[model samples]
Target: MSTTTSNHIGRKISRIRELRGMKQETLAEAMGISQQSISQIEQSETVEDEKLEKVAEALGVTKEGIKNFSEEAVFNIIGNTVTNNDNAAFFNNYPTFNPLEKLMEAVEENKKLYERLLKAEQEKNTYLEKLLSK
Candidate 1:
């Protein structure tokens, strides 16, 4: 740990965005902001609570997750999981369950949501067609 306390919220956001495989432009679109604005936010040391909440939502992470972000913890989790190292170097980084399982769950949930959306669109088209015929 560094002697200086590091509580840079912007860095955390940027790191999480990168790890999520999201482009700055993608995040900007999600937040309804410009890519330049996203760049500015990343440079900021502190962001307002409301903005932070929006950013967290756009990143698909909780506000607390952004607040508590740590590169070391992330590294520990990845290293341990891949190497099957039983050593728990960090308490917070300790996996409560399988990460891969959670990822699969997220994928399945997204698939269901897409199906629901597609169905809704099809129903909407049918309704519009009936109105046109009348």
Candidate 2:
């Protein structure tokens, strides 16, 4: 029998996150962790139970869901659901997209961008002042 690294918990989590259309930064923020920490966790082979619990919550999935996640199954479900004519029934759990959440994400990104731009401008002004003094 061949050994299968396919059961790696980190890989499962990473794949599930991708399936949920979530970025590492988003998950990191939800988990109250640094993005680098999320990246590190994704690269790990195994995570502690407490950390895994936090990750599952951040990902909006149960721990069992993460553990049992299957890409093929996800694709198959999507494929089957999309073929149906009733769009409403296809999404019985929750809507695939949430406009309010998307709007908030956009707002947060814009705020961050503006903050960075402001910082750059401040640095430029400081440099100009130093040059004038010289």
Displacement of the residue 133 alpha carbon in candidate 2, Å: 70
Candidate 1 stretches greater than 4 Å from native: 1-5, 84-134
lDDT of 1 by residue, 34-115 (tens): 9999999988889999999999999999998999888888877788676435544434476889999999999999999999
State the weakest 10-residue window (summed lDDT) of model 1: 83-92
Q: Which segments of model 2 are wrong by more than 4 Å? A: 1-5, 84-134
Estimated TM-score per prediction?
0.58, 0.57
